[model samples]
Structure formats: structure tokens, C-alpha cells
Target: MSVTVERAVCATPSTQRSLLPVVGSGTQVPLVDGTSRVYANLDYAASAPALDAVAARVTEVLPLYASVHRGAGYLSQVSTALYEASRQTIARFVGARPEDVAIITRNTTDSLNLLARIVPTGPDGSPGRVLVLDLEHHANLLPWVQGSGHRTTILPIGPTVAATLQSLAAELSAWQYTLVAVTGASNVTGEGLPVADVVALAHTAGARVVVDGAQLVPHRGFSLTATDADYVAFSGHKTYAPFGAGALVGRRDWLDDGTPYLAGGGAVRDVRTDRTLWQPAPARHEAGSPNVIGAIALAEACAVLAALPDGALAAHELALRTRLVAGLEGIAGVEVLRIWPDSTEPVGVVTFTVEGHDPGLVAAYLAAEHGIGVRDGRFCAHPLLVRLGAPGGAIRASVGVGTPGEAVDRLLIALADYLTTGPLARYVVEDGCWVVADDTRPLIPVHGLDGLAATAAACGPTVEAASGSCRPRRAAHTAA
Candidate 1:
């Protein structure tokens, strides 16, 4: 039986604030007419904004920051202890078995790639084949293709959820697959898969299951032990940590026997000039100085999420999702993508396209005119997008703990505005990206860049001159 946690009530505004503080919730952005509005980030499916609690944890640890598992100094020992303790914390949070190992990685992609390296090959000296669904993120798909030395069979999604499960069961029974890799939720549609059912089917077929929980863990509660999944991978960025850390938690036997992921300092027990003895599981995988802060931040996020009253987070997201889906369905010329239309328990991700408008243009207009940030692309799931008949891509709006009902209303209003009046300013396609033509808003610094002018100047003279213009053009208003 699937272990069910107690579901918490939906979060009120005050409770939402207490659940997790997020960065950039009140950030301002300027529209084409030079008026600034508070930015509404609807792109949590890509990367969520950092939680203020996570930030505070980092700040608390910074002063004592030092190399992990390396130095003998006081700070180093503290850092090392915290790093190792974080492993246990994360594992416990995921409901891992006592024998399971938790290996820290850079992100979900990194974690899956590491697993790819360790997955055992078949007896004939050929690599084992992995069964994967078409609806996987590139992080889950490409690693097995490029690194696992395995032949992957991409299973087509059925028209309905039941049909999809049936297909998986049929395939598992027919093939001697080494692993069954599946996503806990569809990143594109936010539809939660029946992970417990998938696990049962895969296990009955003598295949181990790996769940790409990058999207699921943040929105719903999951237990690896309860689900009987062999492995679970997720990223901290998507879970409101925003630190450069992720985890692969699963069975220890394969990881312990497999070659170390990185052959460096901390991975070895004793090294001779000719040969070296490797450490067990985690230490073997983590060969160098670890991302101590990132790991701690991820653990902090896990702790916070775990402490949330049973279904509080899920309840809040579900309410927002209902509003969003209903609002979008009410709009003309808008089609919301879904793998299973009858699914009643989807997360807060919604992908759609407006009739007669390019997805990129619609996304640009939302940002440029409405200060609403959304993602428009194949979402790194090109095959799924193509399969869904969105070869040109679509718009994705995903919400999280930080998202408010007002944000959902704003998105609906913006979409309605777009349908009624279209974009107020002309858009131009530059280098495959749709951008506002002759935009003059001041540039926002990102990734440690000083300003847009500095970045442009670093690129070239023509771009530098273009970046210097910030005088606003006349407002172009359209009747709504």
C-alpha cells in the first residue's frame, strides 16, 4: 500500500508567508511604456526562486564555511559534520531505507548521469537496456542515451493515464529490461503519475525503477521506501533551495560496487603508485571538495517542506491550479495541454497556446507588457512536445509555494488581454527569441553581471551602443 501522509489544509496568505519566504516575489520590471510593475514569476517549472529560509541558512553557515572532509581545523570539521549530517537529513526526508545511500550531485541531470554510469550491464558483455517514457525531461532522457551504454526504448504515452500504465506493464512483461525510468510527474502538464502503481509493475517484471522526482517532490509528498522505488533523483533549485545541489537516493549495492563517479582525493582509502582502494558509496561518488553550502541548503529545504502540515503545500497548489485551469479554459482560443484530462490531482504546472499567436511572442508580450514571467519553448522535452503536436513549442506557467491566487488572476487577465487586444508593441524575432522591438528599459543585472551595458560592451560596439538607450518610447495602448 502507498504510504499516505496526513494532508494539510490550504495555506492562507499569512500561512503561506510562514511556510517559506521566497526571493523576487516583489521585484519590479518596466513595461514598454516605461511604467514599472511588480514582476509575477510564473515559470517555477524552469527554476524556482530561492526561499528566504534557505538564504538565511546559507548566511548562517557562511562564516564557518570551510573545506568538507579535508581539513583538521575547527571550521573544516564543522563544515564536514554539517555536510555528512545533511546526507542523513535528506535521506530521511525522502523516506529512504536504512541501507539506502544518498549521493549528492550538482543537479538532477548530474544525479541521473551518475546513476547511468553505475547501472550494471547485461551478461553478454553488452549494456543493459532501459525503458523510458517519451514524457521525460532531457535530464532524465539524455544521460541514459549518452552515458549508460544502454539501448533505451522510448515508450509512447497512451491517450489516457490508464492506457499508459497498461502500456508500461505490457512492455515490462515483454522485455528483460535492466531499469525502468519514469517521471513522478509530467513537467509539461504537471500531471502526477501513479508512482506506486508504476513501481509495483516494474518490480513484478524484475526491473528496478528510477523516479525522476525533480518536479514531483516540490509539489507533493513522496516516500521512496513506501513507493518501493529503487532510486529517486531531484534538484534543490526546483524545491525552493536555489543552491547548486541535488541528490540521488537509492539502493547501496550497485553504487557501492560501481566505479567511483569521480576519482579524486576523498574517494580513495589507500593509494599505491600502481593501484588505489576506493571508499564506499557516497564518499566514492563524491571524490573532491563538496558543495557544502549547497548540500546544507538542500537539506534545509527538505526539512522545511517535510515540516509543513501534511497537505498544506499540495492543497495550496491545487487551489491555484484549479483557478488557473478554469480561467484558461474560459478563455477563447486557449488550449491547455494535458496527458490525462480526467486527472483530478495535478500540480500547478499548465502549458497552453493561444490561437493565432506564436508561443514566443505571447511569452514576450506577457513579460514586456504585463511584467509576468513565463517560459515558452519545448521545455527541454522536445520529443514530448512533438508528440503533443506542439512542434513549435508552447507557453508554460508553473506555480509553487511562493505563488499567490492574485498571480493566477493576473495571468488569466493578461491572457484575456492578449486575446482581446493583442500586444501593445511590435515584437521582433532576434536569434530565435521573440523580443520587444526597440526596447529601452534599464537592464537588470544577473549572474553577477554589473549591468546590461557592461555585458553588451563586452560583447561588441554595436550592441554596446544599443544597450545605452533607455529613453522610453510613446505608449501604445490597445482597447481591451
Candidate 2:
């Protein structure tokens, strides 16, 4: 049952390649002044850096890119064919039916907006009821809250599975909601919802469910067909394909009959001065020329995830997360943000607040002083933050395919340092955060790019060597 950890360090973007070439130099950002630093990318929840393979694939296909759909030229035909094929590939990867409409939008936000627009109008022409959880990102929450007069029911995800299920059951039993929009995983704490159970409950109440997979898909592969949800949405940027593209994958009927969310040339099957007949589900929602290049890049990213050796990638991320949680434990004044410790269903992202420290200050110190890149804010999960009694927010450290063990060590070391020496004197922002890292007052790197690269390459392999097994393999890759 033990998983072998496969090294995917070679998968980093070339710009991130270290001097020795094996380990990655901190971030792609060039530190103007020489300082000792390792690019610790702990922002995978917000957006994962593009996989080298995904980027290379995009580059290879860019020159061949042309307008898609019904163009007479060979390039157009090729592009159209590739675009449609990408849809099928994505659908299959996500366990969706081949006929399921896979429409690309700007991001998760855009996909939810489109889904909101297409919801079947409720009885008496009133907007239908929408059920959402307190843990949902604003991207999932705002769309329904702002949608056409939809009566909203904010469902609470209790601290325990039994409590959560019972609460959701009671809510579903009472209301005939049209749609239940839930996050597959919490971006802040990396807690995965019991989506299959939620979907069953919603369906029993005669409501459809929309899963926000932006956080879920990046850390773990997902299958909509097996998920029991009616629709799934996620962003490519979070999935290591930062082309500003996202997908809304679901059944065809709602999209086919619903009014087109965006109206344009490709989306129209027939047009007249008086009236126009809209195209099918995907095209009806996709109005513009479309980010063909972005979609291809995202598809390529998905393919890269698909091709990764068994459970190697997920195990790697999970190992890094375990290290993070363990390292932070017993540290005085550190409070880890968590949802239901009894549940093992989570990705690597972990959030915590250091006592007597501003999250912004801590995050800034990590980035400027240590050359670490982490996110610190409400993380767009304001409601969840409020519920957790965190008025400001928490510092978040997330790992992914490219993150190395040393980077995590550096983060823990930095926090340990902060805990030892009260918050550094220079960390306080006088005017505002914008004033601290302004172009005028740049934080110098201790190690120049060359020195940093050399250190990273030398230290990288050593750090990974300590990742003593206990990793989980991909579901299919395991022999069991």
C-alpha cells in the first residue's frame, strides 16, 4: 500500500531551472539585488505555475493556430478539429460523457456566471432557489446570490461529516432548490467536501448541483461522471495552464434550451436581421472568437497530469503538506486553519495565523526576506474566514508538482525564526502593503541569481531524499 515517490522536478519551467539544472531557482522573478533565497511557491491554490510540458505544447501549436469553425482553409479545419477534440479529451479525463457540453470561459467566475444565466426559470417566472455552502468561494457564492431574484439558502458545512450531512439533509428536505452550488474543495484550508453525498441529497430534493472544481482539479484528478454532480467548473490557471481559461462541463439539455449567455458569430447557427437561431450548448455560451490557444494549453496541462507516473504527483503534494502540518505543530502561537480533522480528504494547501502577527506582514517577510512566494489574505473565501473568527485572514502555503521539500523547509525555518524573534522590525508596513514592496524600495536578494541557483540545485536533491515514503498513488495506478 506504500506509494513510490517519483521525481517530477524536471517538470519545472525552464526559467525556473537552477544553475545546476536539477533543482529550481526560486520564482521566475529576477531578484535585482543578490540575496540568499529559494523560490518557495506556496500559492498553488490561487494558481499553479505552468507545467513545462504544458507550456512547450502551447508553444509548439501556437504558430499553427488560426480561426476555428467552418473556415475554408486547412489551418481553420485543423484548429476546429483540434478544439473539438480537446473538449472530448477533457470530458473523458473528467469522467464526463462525450456528449456533455464542455464550454471554456474566462475562469471559474465566468463559468458560474454563465451557469447562473442558463438556470431554468422557476415557477411564476421567479428566479429559482439556490443552495450554497458557507465554505464556497465568492466565485460560486456571488453568481447565485446576484442571479435573477433567486431565493438563496446558505447551507452550513458542519465541523463533522455526520453534522454536515444531517444539516444538508434537513435543508434539502425543506426546500425545492433549483441548483446547489458547492465547492469540491475549500481553497483556504484544502478541505474537500463530501461532494457525492451532497449531490445525492440535492438530487433527492430534485435540485441540480454545480461543483466548483477550481481547487479540486489542480491537486487531484476528478471525474464528473463518477462525482454524482450535474455540472462541474474549474479554472485552467489553477490547473497549471494559466491561459485565463476555465471550463463548465455538464449535461446538454439545459444549455441547449437556455438563452445564449454570449451571442456572437460562431455561436449562431443561422442569423437574420429579424431573428437568429442559436447554436448548441457549448457554442451558445461561448460568444467570442474564444481563447483557442488557452484551451489547447489547458488540455495539454490536463494531459500532463494524466501522464504523470501513477500516484507520484499527488503523493508528493500530500507529503509536502504533511511535513508542513507537522512542522507547524507544537510551534508556540501558531494556529492552523482546518476543516474537520477527522476527514483525510484534502489537498496540500494549509492556512494558519501566527499569534500577534499580521498575515500580510508574515507573508511579506516570507516573500521578501526568504524569497518564498506564498499567498496571505482571505483567499477569496471571506465568508469562511469570518466563520473561523479570523477577522483579517491567514497565511497560506500550498504545494504542487513543482514544489521541492527544501522550499517547505525554508518556509518552516522562516516561521520558526519569526516565532523566536518577535516579528522583524522591517516587516511592518507604514502606509500600506503597496508601499512596502514598491519599485522604489525593492527587497534585495541575499544570494544573487547564480548563488541562489547553485544553492537550490545543491540542496534540492537532499531535501527530496528525506521524503521517506508514506505517499499515496493515483487510484488507478495502485495494484491493490
Candidate 3:
């Protein structure tokens, strides 16, 4: 059941400051007209900028880093201890149950893929179907779709979010299944789900629940125990720790019962040419050298977020979202996207579309003319995007702890200007994105990156290029 989206009214602003410092919050980016502005980074939904606390933690551990569990040196001992402590820290941050173990992985996608590998099979040697909603990120949706012989049944969205929860309850009551997966919040609309209620329904129907928390952890805090979710996966990058570290925290039985995620060093209790005995997880799955620094940095972010005064984070984000959504809705040609009319508390995400303008053009115009950063396109939730009738694309502006009211005001002003008078610079479709024609923006030169283009040509086409899908090419030149 799908309901019409609702709009929020504008709120009066108070004397509010940024909640915390984030790296690159004040960095100036050159505009196309040889002017510049401090880049208003409103792309937190994609990847949040690093928190100063996380950066400090990384610096503290950089000198102490050594081989994890592969060395007996003093540095190794400290590194190993840090790695283990980090695992525990992340687990506790999510309110992990006593029996739950946090298995560190590369990111949310990697963590979900790992959990997919361990889904239990019946005595008949067939994995049962796992149920999911239609609004999941590809990270949660695709793993189950292309799972190891496990079928997937997606519940249809209801008119209202409340009605959707009812639909989920009915679906679970009627079907016999292995597990149920849902997103803690929708990445496209930023609506938080009734996770605890969903967990109760799934559990009552003899199923477990796993939440994709990549988008939720950065804004709203949740607990595996409070929500009664069996498992949860989240990305550190989204949580203000832009490191390649994430985790799957959940029941340990399935982990130990499954095959090792990777076969290599540190996975074995005993190894011989003829036979080997594997250790229990997470060591069993986390083979090869672990990302010690990344894990530690992620832990630091969790700690900092956990320490925020009660209601401080929520109040900060609510003010930002209010200004964003109300401003977009108030605009003459803009329409903010939402799934449920009853979605009471959404995060600091507002996706909108302007009439008669492509999302690519709007995004390009924002950056080139206003020095603002926003995400455009399907946002990796292709099915959801199609359902929302934004198959072409849409523009998303997400805020974080460091985002100030002035930044929100800037975005609104720039957008209003573009719609009212049209863009100052002409935009043309170029390499899958909109680009200003004959742009004169100078590239920031980095040391030792002169051969970057040569090295790429020497190697081969990037995975995107090879796959016939490439990112928005950053060239200043217009496409052929």
C-alpha cells in the first residue's frame, strides 16, 4: 500500500550552532565563474564527512598499527587489543544482546553479503525464502535476491506507513519463512520504520528480523535489543567515520554454523596439507589482514555519537529537516518526496525535484553556481525510486551534525534563484551528468597525481566503464 507524500510547514529558526566539527566543513570550492564559496556539503546521505573526533582517533592509532594477530611485537599486541576492543565497542553502540557478536566487514554491503552466506537451511537441504519490504537499499535487497539458493518475497507498500505495517503483519501471518529483512529507514525519503513493531510481527510468525541501518545510525539511534531485531548491518562511512569499516552484529549460532567467509590466514585452529580445522567466527570469516585502523576509527565515531546529550542529536536534526523540507515545499516549482503521509519523524534527508529541470542539471547548477554539494539519481534504491515515480532521477540534500542553518538557507536561496531566473550558466548533458558549457573552473592539483590518467589508461577501463555504466565524468568539457 502506497500513500501520498506529506509536506511539513516552515519553522522559525533560533540561535543554533553546529553540533560538532566535521572535516572539510569550511573548505572553499571554486565556482565556474572564477568565484568561490565554502562548499555546503549536503550529501551526508551518500557519505558523511569525517568527524574531528574520528580523525583524532585515527591519528592516535596510526603509529601503533601493526599486523593483527600475526605478530608478537609490542605494536602488534596493542593493535590486536585495539581491534578486539573496537569490535566490542561497535556491538555495544548498537545495544547488542549478550549472545550477539559483531563481525567487522568492509561496509554495509559486505556485511549483508556475509549474513546472506549464513542463512540457515532446512533439513531438506533447501534455504527458505526470506521476506523483505519494497523500500530496501540494494545492499539489503540484492543480497537476498541473488542469495545462495534462498528465495525472496517482497511485501507491497501500503497507502500509509501504518497501513504498510499492517500489511507486513498480515504477510508474515500467512507465510511460512526463514527470515525477514527491512530497512531501519528509507534512504530515498529518510522515513524511519516501526522496527520494533516489525520485529514483533516477524518473531511471532517464527522468523527473525535484520535491519539495514546504514542510513539510520548517522541520525536516529536504535538498539538491536530494544528493537528485538535478530541482526543489523551498518556502514561506518555513513556514521561520520569515512573508513572502509562496517559490521554485522547478530546471533552467533548461525555464524559458527556457516562456512568461513574467506579462506586464508588466521581462520584456522590447525592446518595441514591434508586437513584443516577452522576457528569460530569472527576470526573464521575475517581472513587476511584486518583493517585495524579503519575499525578503530569507526569505534571512535560510535563512542562520540553515544556520548551526545539526550535529545541533542534529535533536536539538531529536526531543525535542519524542518527547514529543508518546508523550504523545498514552499518553493514554486519544487516537490519534496515522501512515501508515507503518516511518517511522523524523518531524518535530515529531503529529496526534491524541480519542474522542467533534470536532476542532473539541478545538481550541476548547484555545485558550479552555488558551491553546494548534493546527491542526485536513484541513490542505489532503484526499485524504490521506480516505485516513487522518480525513475529518471531526483535531487537529494542531506544534512549532518556539522551542517549549519546558514548552509540550509544557502541551498534554499540558490535553488530559488535557479528556478526563478534559470541558471546563470548554461548546462548540457555530458557523460551521464549535466555540465556547464565551456567551463573555466581550475582543477586542484595534488602532488604525485600527474600520471593518474596515464596509469588508468595503462591498466584498463574501470569497472564502471567496462560494465557500460560510469559515474558522472568530472571533465569540464562538454560531451560529444
Candidate 4:
């Protein structure tokens, strides 16, 4: 199963470009030096660029969008049908059994939080104990600690992957744990874990296994039926949909028996002044108006990925990963981070650091000078980063179906240039971030609330005056 870097180096350029249709394949961006280049996006691990097919499907569904499951109009019926069909599409994509249910969520974090709410308490009416490894994203780690009727036991990873599995077996044998949450792959190192093995061990110990598949699903295929995992959670954005949807697919017994995740209109069958009766599995958890468009977009993405010729996408990514890893290893002072050195299975993610430069500065330099996008930070795995002795974090370059081999070459060339001659432009610490000196790019908002005060000021007093006078107006004409 191990493909050497030498074989990947021999792959033709055309073979790399035929991998998948990425949204921003040939997008060009201007660097700080007043030079423009086609952007090289190596930040797929954080949020992958949407697939062109997914975008097209979304556009096609927008004009017909309407309220789902609560209206009798034509568009409503269409939307409702599409939404439920999307659930089945995703369920089949994960190889869910007939009794399993797929619950639409906002993202992996929301899905895990919903599971945490439904996790049954022990005989003492207290939270049951859940086991997790140190190598988890905060999305997977934090939910178990917050409202997850479970006490979390954070286990440390051993020196090797085999040893880590052995440790998990030992821990499970020692306790009557209720559940075991693990990641299908490491977001930091891109190393695949033995998920099937983990599920077998947990099941033998009378515990259910939940996998955070946000990082794994995009790169590799999964089958809940084959693995016998109790639950799998993943984000649509990470899986090339980028439409603000996620899914939690698993066995239905616990979810059907527990209270609804959200309490609202669609979740309940009958509402009274004193008592209310909730609905069944999927509907019970989905309370308010759901994201019909996002769900359809996610389903379309799964269909497109599933339709790819067998082993085509995986082989393309492997070639790119091999080239990037081998190139990084050749550069002096570049240390590649890894949890398992002997593990050859990875998903096109590589993290590294330069000896004399900060990871943030290196990442900024790559973008400001070379127009190569990369992620620099702990990647939301703070505990794992602390254990790896990288409290400040490392630079991560992740590839996907649409990633071209030329982009990998550009990153390698940039890193070598940085190590040999230092950054082309001087960087300074600005607001706790490394930025190129005299750069003249407008600051883009990271989150919706970021720079809210400044945004309001820029809108001026006229906006405030208009807001006071604005009123909801009735529709000019009613359809039915």
C-alpha cells in the first residue's frame, strides 16, 4: 500500500489536472510586491474550496427554494421532498443501515453536541464516562466535556500507532465505558488511524464508537456498515460542499428514545399548555427551518465524489502528498511533524516548521510573496500541539481532489528560498500576527462579528436613521 515518492514524481502534469473540478482552480491574486500569480490553495484541511458541481447544483436549487415540511405550496413540496431525499443520499453515502438515521447539523461541532445531549446517563443518574485520545480537534474533544452526559477521559497517544491501539485496548478493558470517541485521521499530521480496529475493540468492551470524520471523509471513503461504528460526524464545508451543512449518521435507538436536540415547531407532534410530545429520530432533532439548500448541496457533493472512477482521486492526492513530503524533507532546517513515522497512509496534509523563522511568519511570507495559501496554527488541536512541543503551532499545506502538482512545487520552492535567503519582504508582529511590512491589502473580516464597531461606523449615521424607520411590508399579492 506504500507508494514511493519517486513514482509520484514521475506522474505527468495532465494527469494531476484531471483529478477534480475545484471552484477556484485558476484564480489569480496580487502579491504584496505588486506582482500577480495564479493562487495556490494549500489550505484544504481548514476548509476546502467548493467543487464546481456542488456550486452548480446549489445555483439550480436556489430559485425553487421555499419552506420545507411546513407548507403546502408547490415549491414547499419540492423542497421537502428534496430535503428528505438528501437525508437518504447522505445515509447511503456513509453506508448507513436501514435502521440508522442521518440528522442534518450545522457542522461537526453541532453534530457531536447533539450526540452529547442524547448520550444516556448511568444507573446513578449521573453522566457516564467516555474515552477520547489527545489527538482530537477541539470539535471532537470539547463536546464530550460540555453537556455530554459523560465524563471524558483524555488518553495520551503512545510512541507508535500500534502502541496507541494497544493503549486504547487496555483502557477499554479496565473500565465500563459508555462510549469511545476517536478521529478517523489526525488533522495535524494527516495520518490515518485504525478506525475499524478501534470500533472492534470498543464494541467488545460494551461501548459505542463515534468517529469525527471531518478530516477523513474528504480524502478517503468510509462505510459505517463495514466498520460497525455507532456514529460518524462530518462537516459539509470540509467535504467540498462549503454550504454550511453537516451530518450525524448512526444507529437510531438512542436518538429515538431521547429528547429532541432542539425544541421547536417541527420537532414536536403535539404541543399543549402543560405537556408536549416530540416526533421521531431525524425530525425530533431538527427543530427550526432547516438548511434545505445546504443539505442538497452536500448531497450533490457526495454524489459527485462517489461517481469518480474508483481509486482515481485517492491516487491523485497520494502523488501530490508524496511529492510535497519528499520535497520538504530535502530542505535544510525543515522539520516535518508526525504522530506515526512508520504510517505511510495519509491524506495529502503535511505540517512543518523552519528553524529560524516563526510558522506564522513563514506562512505569511508564502502568501505575501508567492501567492501560496497555507494554514499556520495549532489547527484546533491544542493539546496535541502542546504534546508535540509546538505551542506556537506549525505551517500546514493540505491538498485535495483539485490540487495541482505545480502548486506543491511552488510551495517547496518558496520554502527553500525562505530557508536559503530569508523572506523577500520583512515581516512584523501586528496584533499578535505576522504581517508583511508596508502591505496595502484591506483587512477581510474573519467572522461575521469581527470589526463590528468599525463596520457600523463605516455605514454612518444614515444607516442608524434608516433602521429606525424601516418596517416590514406585506406582500403585494398572495399566491394561495
Give the winner by lDDT: 1 or 2: 1
RMSD of model 4 against the true structure: 8.5
lDDT of 3 by residue, 385-471 (tens): 788888877899998898988888788878877766678887766556677765556544666644544444443433333422222
List the global CA lDDT of all models: 0.82, 0.74, 0.83, 0.83
**Backbone clash numbers for all candidates listed:** 3, 10, 6, 0
Compared with the true structure, model 1 gives a TM-score of 0.90
Off by over 4 Å in 1: 1-19, 123-126, 445-451, 454-480
Model 1 weakest lDDT span, ten residues long: 471-480
RMSD of candidate 3 to the truth, in angstroms, is: 5.4
The segments of candidate 3 whose C-alpha lies over 4 angstroms from its true place after superposition are 1-15, 448-472, 475-480
Q: Return the lDDT, model 3, position 187.
A: 82
The list of candidate 2 runs beyond 4 A from truth reads: 1-36, 123-125, 422-425, 428-431, 434-480
- Following a full C-alpha superposition, what root-mean-square deviation does model 2 have from the true structure? 11.4
Q: Model 4, range 1-480, lDDT digits (tens) per residue?
A: 121222223233323563788798888877876778899999998899999999999999999899999899999999999999999998888889889999999999899989888888776787788999998998899988875557889999988888888999999999888899999888888885688999999999999999999888888878899899999999999899999999999999989988789999899999999999999989999999999999999999899888988988788888888888888877767788988866667887888877656788888889888999998878889898888878778899999988988899888877766765667777766445676665543334446544544544555422432332111111222100
**Which prediction has more favorable TM-score, 2 or 3?**
3
From the highest TM-score down, the ranking of the candidates is: 3, 1, 4, 2
List runs of model 4 lying over 4 Å from the truth. 1-15, 123-126, 441-480
Error of 3 at 319 (Å): 0.5
